[model samples]
Target: MDQLTQIIAVLGVFLYWLILGAVATRIVIKRRSIGVSFSWLLIIYFLPFVGVFAYMLFGELHLGKARSSRSKAMYEPYGKWFSTLYSHNSHQPDKQSDYAASISKLCDSQLNIPSLTSNELELQHTPEQILHAIINDINHAKTTINMEFYIWHPGGLADEVAKALISAANRGVKVNLLLDAAGSRQFFKSEWPKAMKKSDINVVQALIVSPIRMFFRRMDLRLHRKIVVIDNHIGYTGSMNLVDPKYFKQGDGVGEWIDMMVRITGPVVPVINTVSAWDWEVETNERLLPAFPDKAQCTDTSSLVQAIPSGPGMPEEVIHQVLLQSLYQAQKKIVITTPYFVPSEQLLDALVTASLRGVEVNIIIPRRNDSTMVKWASSSFFSELLAANVNIYQFNDGLLHTKSVLIDDEHCLIGTVNMDMRSLWLNFELTLAVDDIKFATKLKGLLQTYMDNSDRLSHDEWQKRPMYRRVIEQVFYLFSPLL
Candidate 1:
């Protein structure tokens, strides 16, 4: 009995040491941020078995070697197409402005999108307005309609848009639809996709996560971009998902969601089309020609718009860079609204630094969040921001789902990216950078409306929170890096 026990003990020690070595090797090999690597290291060291399993599922950003290679491969064709069509632009006089030059140069060098002038943009605030406008645009589609969303629940406006897409497809307009598998998992498994397929509308699921594929591809990396292009003339993007605001989920307490989207027309349309094409090619391996190769000249507007697409496939974080630069450029004021605010250390520091430099920085978030963990993690930053003289507002009207940034009265960014780690590092996101006084003024007005309905959170109020809640929030904050 003693001999057998000794042999089992030896085997157990060897296995434990092997697991430690394996976990350490994986964390080091991934080349993650030091803070993130250290966090995972600590987890693996303390909770050996559970950490090993969690690391296998979510620790490493292994989005599949084959998929990563294919994403890179598809970019070449996207580059060629963008270069060819964008080179012939005759109405790019606004690109020479200093305000446009700084941001344009940054994005051009990093994201391959030039600062484009001659674009008309309209901001839609309510879900009803946004959905109606989208369906109308779909009904007016002449040649093609391309749509992509993170969450595409079928009902209400989604059903209306579905019927419109079906009608457009029957009329010989090539309709293409793409939705993230994890975001729209139930929809992907429903009969809606099959019905759309039968109607000749090409549909593709982005970054599918399945039991079999989970062992190969990273299931955590999702496609969170929201894009829509109609006949290469009209495009829409923002935080608005395809589901109704009233019935987004089974939740009962939270009221209607307040979301926003931007409708664009001009040279920027083709640029947005290129983003959709790149995603389509990456998932379906089918190159999509521009619905309208030749863009219409629009000298009626002075807005210089650029569509910046950022994701794991890219060599750099394009939107994150823009956000940081915009914060530094803020001289008068900065107003931001997002559903999630679990920002990276760099982003949080930028906001604090900007406020310290005498810029008025206001951050608006929902009063009640969809994720309790995210809400607590977000609240932990309030004390630091309040000390920096940054105004923090929690929306009381409803769930403020708009992801937007307005810097001063001339620079603005509206899109699907939230102020969170997952948006900045893990998921694919898109943003529209607009440099126009008129548009920025309107955006500022809209933000003012939100402020009028929000309750400003004071540092004093934050300190009065119960001890247990504070402890829970701080604990969640420690895991913000992973969040």
Candidate 2:
């Protein structure tokens, strides 16, 4: 019996090795990023069972075959609509600098988002200001109010937003609200959606999840964009979610989150609205394209703005390529503010190479992150970033929830995209490329404010971190592609 047990154990080990070999072959055949493929290999190499489950759960970027088919069906129409929307604005000359023109051209060609000119933009900061502005727009919404957000915590000012939406719906305004199933799980459990529905507002959830359905979809693929279009004229998008800082995540020891939102008014509003419409149509199979601004309406503009939307079915590396271009294009200074900072090798290399070539690269992240894995993984990249003179500062006041990249004094990249892999590669994100000098100046000053309250990391000091912490960071770094 003892001999039989030993032989069975050896067979079990051999079977495990065989399974791993099969998984490795599949991963390499998939041809994911080198880091991602290797990370999965490491995860499987160590915790054989957990790694296999994790890879099964997250290894692929399949949002689902259903979504893929729907996307392919709509791809042609969506691209044509976007092109027509921009063509109407051709009367307005492309008054962008060479730098902005190149970046905008990349967005047009790669992301299929054409740039519009002459749009008015107001950069709103703080929860109080953003909520008030959005609520005011909701209150005044005459025809329609469309909103989508990742998280919508039910309390404080967010309740007020709910109230505003309710009131708007009661007043016969066609209101539509879209929330992510995972991020806004708490909101779904709350009474806000119910109350809004009572007022006849169309409240739909994106990327719905369940125990059984998890096998069919990548449950982690999130709709991370915050977008609102009021009356198909006023548009808002930024890092601010539907959560009020005062009531959300208070006990986490990371103070209230600091965020920013932009109030946009011009032809670009339609672009933003159309993006929301595409999302609504995709999730519900109900087309809201007609509700978007017409080609004639797209003619009026005040500033150069290009709306770039990226996600699972979209170009995987559109935003990543744009950021690389921005970094490479930066001749003077580059300031970036984001909550998460687990960047890919190309992103890290871009920053390092930019700094080496005499461009000042400043990155401001929160001192205390909400995710332990993100914190350690972010720190692990610091060794290379710091050595290359890329200045990294941890914001001390609160989680710097604003995701922004200000290049020189002429171009600005803002919206829901983060400096993390999930955002770059998986999540549905919306980004606005502004070729306006005024907006860039405002964003620059705002980032400077963040830097003022941040603590800079020194290369020597960072290298001197305790061995255990460094070890933890490296361990986390190995799984950054998973983060």
Candidate 3:
């Protein structure tokens, strides 16, 4: 062969071996599922040079030290607080003793989280209500305020919230704000309010991305948490980002953004505040402790709540395991509402098994997804679920961003966890696991609202799509393991 042809052959051979080595390394190091491993192998084999680069850049899984430090810092305070609360609360016998013990077992087994007493959880629906609650809480803050969100824009309601934060800071409340670099790129590009700095408010960006750093980090792994902790006593978290009506406003006659938020007080607020502090410490080299006076005296009479935080840095997929276990334990019903519905194989099996065992399994997903590929991949799962007797509903009114799970009308999970591989393994996510019948009932009511507006997909309806669309879904499904 001529020199050029020999050179080309040698380069191709080198690329092939490199990819093989990378795949083998990932399997050994990450210990990912067979599907994920095989999917990586296929990507490298079929896509050649581009695939190799993508794998090198985005495929190498590393549970880095930063995540570990953040998790440790976040959980240490909770551990201390929980140890004290459990000793005090577990000794006294009450009506919620069994529920508290169950919560303790769940924390120890599933999330390794410590259970605390003296926390109140109030479920709030609608953006307007949540916003009003947040503003009211901030206005009453005496010591400090911490706000962290994936998105922060200066317009409409967001602008008003920003003004509220500034006002709180000006009123001697120490305000610390953190926004995800990837999600709030616009806020960073344009100078944020200079008055924030003037008012002694600290603002930091989480996971800043640069052109050079993009080669190593997948920008998709976002800090997709929305938390606002005030006075280390009151907290808020859910699907709502700190944006305005423009985001939800139906341009071209679409629909409004429907979401949910939970206002939490008592012991869980400190946990949420600790997580915010951990995130702030990771971004800026400053450690923050609770600034407010101790006011975590048990206020509510019923229900138990545990705050669970999971991310790539964690040893296990705690949130995913929790969901799977809940599904297995679900006897009557499993109701889930998420904007995205691309679940992993294990999760799919759990849902399918539950459905086959006569559990009323229902999932509500958005009819119009922001991500096209994810929508296709999600749609592909309908056939299998339909076959297994699982009910599926598409929210046709607007985009559904609520992430919640109601299991058997006895337990509920609410927070940032979405039923997707990204949420399960990559993102730093938080969810409040509640063992309250009332909370579960409230969650069921919220799910029912979506179900009322949504259109149920029958097997016939799903199978009636065009052949090309089916092919597209199948193609997307083939890569679902990767997604």
Worst 10 residues of 1 by lDDT: 291-300
Report how far off residue 360 is in candidate 3 (Å): 0.7
Note the residue pairs that clash in candidate 1.
none
Give the top-scoring candidate (lDDT). Answer: 2
| Model 1 regions more than 4 Å off | 25-31, 90-97, 250-252, 291-300
Q: Give the better candidate number (1 or 3) by lDDT.
A: 1
TM-score of 3: 0.91
Error of 3 at 6 (Å): 2.5
Task: Write model 1 residue lDDT over 122-163, tens digit each, in one string.
Answer: 989887898899999998988989999999987678778888
RMSD of 3: 2.9
Clash counts for all predictions: 0, 5, 1
Instruction: Sort every candidate by lDDT, greatest first.
Output: 2, 1, 3
Name the 10 consecutive residues with the lowest summed lDDT in model 3.
88-97
Q: What is the TM-score of each candidate against the true structure?
A: 0.95, 0.95, 0.91
Tell me each candidate's RMSD, in Å, in order: 2.0, 2.2, 2.9
